[model samples]
Target: MDQEQIPGGPEGTGRRRFLALATGTATAAGLGSVAGCASGGDGTSGATLKGKGAGKGSTPEPGPGGFDVKAENARPGNADWRVTKAGPARAIEGFADRVSVLPGESFGLHVSTTAPRFTVSAYRMGWYGGARARLVWRSEALPGVRQPEPAVESGTRMVRTRWPRTATVDTKGWPEGCYLLRLDAQGGEGQRFVPVTVRSAAAAGRTVMVNAVATWQAYNRWGGYGSYDGPSGGYASRSLSVTFDRPYDYDDGAGLFLVYEAPLIALAERLGIPLAYATTTDVARERRLLEGAAAVLSPGHDEYWSPEQRAHVTAARDAGSNIAILGANCCFRRIRLEPSELGPDRTVVCYKSSYEQDPGFKRGHPATVDFRSAPGADPESSLLGVIYDGYPVDAPYVVTNPGHWLFEGTGVKAGDGFAHLVGVEYDKVSTGFPTPRPIEILAHSPVVCEGRPSHQDTAYYTVPSGAGVFATGTMRWVEALDATGDGRSGANHGLDARAGALTTRVTENLLRAFAAGPAGKTHPAQDNVNAVYGGS
Candidate 1:
């Protein structure tokens, strides 16, 4: 359900749109229990059910799944303010507070609930003769908890549904207009509705999907083996053979470096673009997935890579797909996954030495681009012009290329404040065919380079390939998200709009550039032969 279109836009062709987002409803139980919420019901259980709702005020009912729907504050000693419902079937029973939406503004429905298990559903309430309304969003009381309703649903019911949250709806074809939004219960609760309006399409051109799901291990390794919450500390922390398949909670201190993803995702949506997600493995295996995608985003800490994944993305770009490495240390290493018979999935398996020493590693395909001609192969560094500095922090950065096109809209004066944005610095013994060149020096500083430790970061580069390739030289994009408790506000970071706009504009221009031009055309004129075999 796409809520992006407002009535009477350029696409005069009429179509139905979809959208979803919910707020203010009863809470449900936690993941470990089956009480309060309607369960799969395998029989023997102690959980009860009740149903209650507000507005015209339905009386509290007696039976399984029943409760009073009131707005009274919690008792003096309680810190949690909540709403609850008991019912025999799963249901949506409250309004996220009625919202009056302008013609194109984004509005969220806030809901709180306690049903042990609950789902928030929003449907267009009133009737419109020839107009179509979309419920473009649906989120859960809890983030990261997977509930499949077009509306928000919570895995554990005791928590309140949050704002700035999201759910996916297919709103690709709705005529702009006003519509009612409401919640519908799935298995335990009944149905309810709220109202929302569609604003003008003044912001569609700015729409660009922000991708936070890591194709690699640095920021997203939540569920597979070797997850941070799993037995081992994962990847760089250790050289263990662990595979991670789940997501990390940004609120959890462990994700401090990867949290920038939240706002980027949020901002993209606010700008009218859908923020899509995927594991690197998915990109490698799915081509149709990226079809129609103008820009391909690798946000926050995208540190790992697979042979197939790299090849497809490069193909997409060569075919004119724009690319954004929103953070540093991108495409740093490669790993192979081995399947498991039990438990989540195979760990992000890697044994690089076998590639150098074993014929099998050389005979079979390796994931990243390898331009190495002989024995020692470190294609990643060669491809990117720098290798991992192996250090976590460094001196602040300085700008040398403030005049570049990326800095166009921002009134940034050279040498004012640059390194403030960089998170890491890296360098290598520059050499060979894959060497970075015709690069624009965005920023440079006299610091110990990663390789020499005595002198580096003295130079930082942003290369332009028919399409521009911007590199921050530092791996600190996550810091922008952390600037404020909420990722969208830039003032929280002490960065003026210019600095904030720097990130936003670069992203905007890059996506637009990709959509406007063909990929591979940027590379030096070469034969049509595939540069990397077996990918396309």
Candidate 2:
């Protein structure tokens, strides 16, 4: 939720009155004037942040207990240490960014404050059964010693500590959902909530499952900021891999990791729809996981794919199935994963070398086929009318596929706008990707050089097999909904209500289509979509 900025009043009377009122209220409530223990942590409540035994006028002695926004200059009475603005608070955001763990993976949460900083702890919240709530992940702050000063990076001051910010948390048994990680500091005015989602399960149902053949699970490794943010590491390069010690953790690499298909899940739960988690690998095994599923949900950032996964899904749809591709740069590369034990137990290494380096690892193998036109290429591009385009650009999206049933209740128009929906701009069905022209151009956003390059966002052709696929090449779709209450309003952020609803409907449509099939008929598209399309 966006915070409304309150206008500041006169310097003297206004400020004095506000402080006086706050002090009176605090006193009445038995709250301390000095920075004190925050509520709901293992530490004592109401303890000031002031250091214990130090000469007056000298630096205050370090306070006992944990502080979320630790800083050397921070003091019990300091007001500047607080974050009163919207968005991430500069002091503690570094520790609140993305945290990615594989299925059944365990990891730690680290928190360090600036010099003169206090203490902090973390918690988790999300949708359960249907309501929003949270649970404390830590009973108390992990132990650590404070240093007076630490090395500076990017010309900014930071405190150094060896606290056990690390822990062994696993993702193996949790159902896929949006999780909010709240970090709070002693003496700090408020808490910071970081949004993270457990990657969707690669299993379809009781039996069918998608495999995680070659999965690259690192964020900020290719470091590119949002389309509007400054250019950073590896933005211009196609791909590269960095080797780090097993269970490697970072505080600076927060920008790259974000929520996928965030809004769709919320909608599914709200509308009483069940979602199945699976990867391309599961699809290849002819697993019955998806057999009885009402809908298949692929959240944002589903870029890597395998040929068999593509073919089976298309075949299932031909028999009758529904699919929703919630984000962009999806189904672009056919990748191969060679398992290794050098990393954390569940961590797999997915190095991006040229597809030609090893013919066996090429895109045509069962693991890496491009399903574009059948026997070989991934059918995703042809099915969705898009291919993963290169990235680092954001542009407004225009609706062109207006006639499709997906827009049935949306009341959207031809020129209606969806902003920054396409990132890296690669898929344009009208131009190529073997997409049929008869496919409706429900939405189209024009692009031009802003010194850099751009691409168009388009939704094209349905499967000859009777399935419907929806793809948006934008990174912000799920995130946008959180910024705006309604997708079409464009108020809180740039999210569009119609866009949000359409995506959800499309996902439901696909799953329902797939479920309308025989118990073992994996590619039941024609039966699912209620239509028929046969190559012969």
Query: Each model's C-alpha lDDT?
Result: 0.35, 0.37
TM-score of every candidate:
0.50, 0.53
Q: Write the per-residue lDDT of candidate 1 for residues 288-340, one digit (tens) a residue.
A: 54544455666665666665566766555444455666665566556554442
* Highest TM-score against the true fold, candidate: 2
lDDT of 2: 0.37
Evaluate residue 74 in candidate 1 and report its C-alpha lDDT on the 0 to 100 scale: 12
Model 2 lDDT tens row, 1-536: 11111111011111111111111001111211232222223211222221111113222222221111122112222122222422233334323112333433444434433323333322122233323322322223322222122221131111122223222222333224334444444445334444344434333321121222223232322122111111332322312222111111222221222234334444443433333434444454444545544335455555555555556656654554555555665665554433222222222222222333434545444433333433344445665656555444556666665555545666677767765455433354434446533344455566653464544654534555445555555555544444434534434234555555555554454334433433123332122111111221
Question: Candidate 2: lDDT of 194?
Answer: 45
